[model samples]
Target: MKFTSEEDTYSWAVEFGKSLQPGDKVAMFGNLGAGKTVISRGVCKGLGFEGSVCSPTYTILHEYPNNPPIFHFDLYRLEGGADLYEVGLDPDYLSQGISLIEWPERLEGNDPGLTHIIRIEILNETEREITLEKI
Candidate 1:
C-alpha cells in the first residue's frame, strides 16, 4: 500500500499488528530513511507496549516486554550469518516472541515459513510504498 504520510504508514502498521500472533516473524526490507522504524513503533503501540521504540542499529536487538514480548532486531550492521547465530537468533527465539527483523536480506536461510515480509520503498521525504507479502 502507498502511504502519503507517516500517519498513514503507522495506521497500516497498526492494522497489521492486529493480526500478529506470538512467534510471528516479520522481516522488513528497505533502505535507509525508509520509515521502517516508524512502522515498528506503530506495532509497539498496537501491541500495547508503553516503552520507547527505536531502531536497534548499534545494539543489534531490543527486547520489549508486552504480554508476549517483542523481539526487534536490526541486522544492518551484521557481518555475516555467523553473527546472527552468535547472537542466539536461531529458531528458538522465534518460539519465544514476535520477531521483527530489519535488513533481513543478510539472513542465511530459506522461507522460514509462515513469515510476513514487508517491503518499503521511499516515494518521497514523507511518503512510502509498503508491500506486505505473506510466505
Candidate 2:
C-alpha cells in the first residue's frame, strides 16, 4: 500500500484491523521513524481501545483493556527470545488477545503461527510503502 501521509497510514491500519481475530498475531517490520507506532495506534483504535496507544519500548509490553483486548510488544531492548518469558509473554497471554509485535526479529525462535507480517518501507520523505503479508 502507498501511504502519502501519516493519516493515510493510520487509516489503512484501521481497515486492516477490521480483519483481525482474537489470538491473531501480527509481526511488524520497519526502521525507526517508519510510523510503526502510528499504525499500531490505529489498530488499537479499530480494536476499541479508547486511550492513547504508545510504543512499549521501555515496558516491553502494553495491554489495552478492550472488548477483544490488544497486546502491543516492543522487543527493542531484549537480547533475544529467551527474554520473552521474563516479560510474561507466554502462550496463554498471546492466545487470549490480539498481539502486535514490533522488532519481531528479536524473537529468536518464537513463532506462534503469525497471522500477518506488516512491513513498512520509507519510499520518500513523505511517502511510505506498507506491505501486509498474510500467513
Clashing pairs in 2: none
N/CA/C clash count, model 2: 0
lDDT of 2 by residue, 53-85 (tens): 999999999999987989998888888764567
Q: What are the per-residue Cα lDDT tens digits for candidate 1 across 36-131?
A: 898898887888788999999999889999877898988888765535566447677666778788888766663434379999999888879899
The lDDT for every candidate, in the order shown, is 0.82, 0.87
User: How does candidate 1 fare on TM-score?
Assistant: 0.91
Candidate whose TM-score is highest: 2
The lDDT leader among the candidates is 2
Root-mean-square deviation of every model: 1.7, 1.3
lDDT of 2: 0.87
